[model samples]
Target chain A: MIKVQNLRKVFRVHKKPPGLSASLKSLFRRDWIEKVAVEGADFTVEEGEIVGLIGANGAGKTTLVKMLSGIIHPSAGEARVLGYNPWEKHDAFRRQISLIMGQKAQLWWDLPGADCFQLLREIYQIPQQQFDHQLNRLTQLLNVGEELNIQIRRLSLGERMKMELIAALLHSPRVVYLDEPTIGLDITTQKAVRDFLLSYRKEESPAMILTSHYMEDIERLCERIIIIREGELIYDGSLRKVIEQYAPYKRLTLHLQNQTLDESSKEIFSKMGEKVQIQSDQVSIQVPRKNVTEVAAELLRKFKIHDLSIDEPEISDTIEILMGGKDLRQE
Target chain B: MFVNLAVQLVVLWALWTAVFAESGKELVGEWDLTGILSYGVMVFLTGRVVRGGDLQMAVASEIYDGSLSRYLLYPLNYGVTKYAQQLGNVFPNILQSIVMAACILPFMGSSSSVDLHVTGLLMCMPSLILAHLLFYIMGLLPQLVAFWADNVWSLSVLMRFITMLLGGATIPLSLFPEWSQGALAILPFRYLFEFPTLVILGKVSVNDWLTGLLTCAVWCVVMSLLVIPVWRRGNLRYTGVGI
Candidate 1:
């Protein structure tokens, strides 16, 4: 369980102009800029609930997670995880939670993952039986059977990430914060990671707060999604509700048996959708959800259909809209 | 430890032989073969006790990798952990220094015209340990600067060099000018090397020993006080960047 109230984090950064002269001048007279990284953000995650924290880059998602995990103290306000003040950093509090970052690793570089796991076992003071059981289960689930004995540096990114997940979860934490857990992984590996997370959540019933740019991960793992923008919470509710609120259009792609349609027929379909682009034998159209059925019926009656598919607008698009079309910052 | 010591002893023998051959004597000043042996032992011990490299590396790496935040979160005191780690290093250092001394003692032989009082030598051991602790603390103060400074390695190395020179690790404090000697005597650096060596050599009076011990005590207290405030301020300034 986690509770956060009016949390804020401001970073003071030195500003300097380019060139040798400016660099020299900065030594004597420097400018300081205060940027609000996380501004008065608030959220609560109940026990055993899997929540997806959705945001574009610089949405303060990681900042909020850091505060909850006790990695950094909040500039203001209060955050409590599992009834313990996170910033206080009590061992008991640490024992109950784990923070896993996809870009950064906790595994020993030159040493094998198994050795690192053993070191963590001692550090966490895990019971021998529990450590062995968890290690076996997690390695099996992540499908990193033989990779455990190999040095971490020799493993691929996906394998290393799996090991990182295992290292973080070896203690069987009650609360887990996963920041972009599936980032940079291939589709199959991403799906495997998602499946593992889902299964782990089900079995352990830990409160998990996940942040990932990939919508598929959220779709598969989280029923609840919280969208943040510019250090503020913009949307907090069900995933379906977020999609319905921001993106009301369905993406329709039609494959036609005839490569070319008459100019007038193309014009008619153009009137039915906002953006229509024809490529090769496929005609792609963005149509409002309400008009999808009617539009498809009209197209079926008018043209020779070969293959057709309908898809909802990506969650990334909804997030971009929520953030006012700002570019997403990559970690 | 033994391996490292044997290597150092070989280097020391080569250095002393060169100095003696060039000078056309067995020694220089009051330093005979025995005194030179003591000097070599002290040098080896000082170098061994200088655990500043590891401490600086640990601090810089933690700060650079953003794992320093992990320290802030834990209930354990950072200062206590540092002290404990330094203490752990001392064991290997002492063992190595003894091995090096043993290797050099054979070369000097029993014919050397010098005597070591067992009681005084025993007393000097604790003094040497305290001196090492003082040096370590002094070294540690600069390491905390890594929280703010970009290049802590060069800064730490510069500081360590200055401390070694001023602390009489390179040469005896007696060889310096009277005013410089007086200044060094009051500073923590002299207490770290010169005073401990003098005590072991039986060259220090009871009053001088007490004064040196008191000076070291005051420095320890002052440095201990200074460290916390600096650390707290530094932690506030830490952005926990690259986490």
Candidate 2:
């Protein structure tokens, strides 16, 4: 379990102007600015719960993860993972958790992946039998048994990522913090990684906090979603609630019978909510969730329709709306 | 790497050979050309075996580039891990030194008036390892300055030159003024090279050997203790903010 209250990280960065003259001047007198990377994030996650942390660039997802994992101390407030202060870096606390950052590699580049895994085993003091069993299962699930023997640098990025997962999970940590685990991987490889995490969680039920920009990764794996923007927590709830609260309109597609939309029809469709697309024989419109029935009846009476369909708003679109400064709170 | 080493060897050989050749043994007190040449060979050989400049840079780059997060995340001591990695580099250098000494030692003879006292040489082993610890700490001290500076490459280079001069690698300690040698003895650098060389040559009395060992132990403890505070302060400012 993880609990964070008012967790914040403020970075003091040096400011410098461009050009040689400014650079020379900065040598004697430099400016310093405090940039808040993560601001007042408060959340609690229970066992076997997978939470998706979504945010734009500089949204503080990585900063929050770093604080919880004890890689860096927070500027203010407190956080506890499994009732232990992460920044204290107690040896017992470290043994129970694992952090996998996508851009930064944990494996030894010059050595084989197997070597790093062995080193991890020693560091965590895992029992040999458990280490071998977990290693065997994780490798088979990721289909990377053969790749582990090769030097890590020689493997493709996707392959290396798979090995990184195995390395992080070999000790069967009780809690895992994953930062963009599927980043830079091909679609198929991305799917494979998602499947591996899902299956691993089913068996181990580790408390996981996954931060990613990929909407599919969130929709497919995380039931509880936390959205942050500009270093502030904006929304926290189920994925379905996010769609219901932020995206209040359903997409309506209409196929006109042997006729294109004339000027009068275009004017009528625009009244519904927003026109998504217009074509020779088909037109798409967005309709508010409450007025769906009334709008459908009106459109049916005015237009000679062939077929019509209504679709729930997409999670991606809902995320966009949430990030677009919509007041989408559903407590 | 060998080409660079050969060039450096030639330069050092020329410099010392010139000093002795022109001064006609006056420049090297109580030492002839053979003695100076013998000391020069030992200096270069010692450098080959027990270098710390590269180790410092390695640590600095890791700290600057954020790869140190790997150690911070794990339950291992970063200092001990780095020291172990550095210690691994010494074995191959020891092998090279052995091979080179086998080929070169016989030709120098007693003209150098240098004695390879078997007992003293045996006693120097522990002191040599202690010296390695001292240099390892010395290498790491300036690197922790990376918490404030962007690059410590120049600092490392400067530290190397100072160690080479004061540690008796560039010139034997006997060539310096007696007072200067006394001051150098109070510092840790002389233990890194000159004291070990003296211990090996049986120049130090038994009482002096015990005292020298105690001094090396004290420096080792002091430097090791210094790392704790430096590392703590460095970590406070680290942030680990970069990608």
Candidate 3:
């Protein structure tokens, strides 16, 4: 449903120092800086797939989404959404695509969501029956049937976001670009949104690219993930593989019944794992994933332990490591 | 806003009355005090229709805050959608103009010169709508500068002032010296403001009506065509950020 090759965008922005003097000086000689927003990005998404785009702020995630949605033209490279060049913005291409932004609303703020949907119905030239059916289905799924009559600005952010989703999907677009759909939503609302997208995928199966920083949003919604950092795609694969590769160590923590630990016990744990820390009543160790079980068994047999736990590194921590220029994959 | 306009009319009525009295002339620039006062009332009425606040900050703010992404994604022309949204503001303002003309036109001038032309009034409707379109595009052209500049408020204000003066909303174009009137007449401003008022007041002959409509229509076509290129180039640089 989507094909992108060497998709690049360079933004030429004026650079100026702050103050009235710099403002006046810029009148004659302004400095220009070219920042590569997306650097030779290459990826494709298939029908019925939800690909999560992961990046910290200013990491070009949104830029990639924008270029694919045809909202902004790329300075270089090519992208075809649903077999049409997205940047060309053909009318048929636009009709088949939808962009739902969590921070910005697609519906008119002063008007009711229902009224905005009516306008969208006309804009897309949807059949009356299809428009009515989709409106009913989406509003019912989002459970915003009652709130549709109220002015959009009067609703809460979560409610407004639900309305935005309905608006974007009113015509059953074939390709969807969702940028930070769960950014400001509450936990319950986020879950609701994620669940809705899951069900929607089951029903419509449109190729989707969801860009978000929320780990849960990515974990619960996207099976495949692409990690972007510094305007480049560093990793793209299954989330489990990412966790297995980037997070190679398992954290073994033990709560001890004894207030003191012997030197021999410390030496034994130090031999088993790196970064072993022995406190008064507890010991925590970062052990290799393959040997975590053996180390834990040894510790349990030797120590008078009150509690024991083993946890793999979090996906967020792994992403942070990648973003900070450490590549555990090399090892 | 209505109250502010009302206050300005009262103050201008007294000021113009004094000006004609002090000058000790029956007509200033070929318009008697009563004619100028009637023109002032028409200015307010036409101003309501042509200068509806709906289009004022909408395009500029969207360009700045990246709210335009909503429009960009939809399968619709942004310019047409913007104009359709402003139509809601126009209908009410048009009704208000009619009500004010009916209630206040007689009081502005009791002279026979305030003659209402039934045919001219009917003919003004299409041209009035054309003027509204022309004004909308002109105002929007400068606001699109926000694609590069941070704010276009100063340009918007400057456009408002220039339109008010040259369109005869602030001062009648007849009052301008004869040499400048030729250039002023060639501009689209007068067709937007004063032409409709002149048509209703029976000051326009059939030939003038045809000329005014043609000028307004031609300007609308030219300016509407101008928006396509400007919007296309501007979209090339649009970052679609901030939202």
Error of 1 at A259 (Å): 9.7
Error of 3 at A103 (Å): 1.8
Pick the lDDT winner: 3
lDDT of 2 by residue, B141-179 (tens): 989998878879899899988988899887778789877
The models' CA-based lDDT, in order, is 0.79, 0.84, 0.86
Residues A150-207 of candidate 3 have per-residue lDDT tens digits of 9999999999999999988989999999999987999999999999999999999999
Per-residue lDDT tens digits of candidate 3, residues B1-243?
467668878887888889889999888886777788887887778778877645887898998888998788888888988898788778888887787778776666465455566886798787778888889999889999988888899998999889888998877899889999899999989998889888776788889899889989999989978987998999998998721
Say which prediction, candidate 1 or candidate 3, comes out ahead on DockQ: 3
Q: Which residue ranges in model 3 land beyond 4 Å of their true spot?
A: A253-260, A275-284, A289-311, A327-331, B112-114
Best by TM-score: 2
lDDT of 3 at B27: 84
- Which scores greater on lDDT, model 2 or model 3? 3
True contacts kept of 3: 0.66
Estimate the lDDT of model 3. Answer: 0.86
lDDT of 3 at A244: 85
**iRMSD values, candidates in order:** 2.8, 1.6, 1.8
Second chain TM-score per prediction? Answer: 0.83, 0.89, 0.94
lDDT per residue (tens digit) for residues A12-51 in model 2: 8989989999999989999999888888999999999999
lDDT for A4 in candidate 3 is 93
Q: State the displacement of the C-alpha of residue A91, model 2, in Å, after optimal TM-score superposition.
A: 1.5
Report each candidate's C-alpha RMSD, comma-separated, in the order given. 4.6, 2.1, 2.7
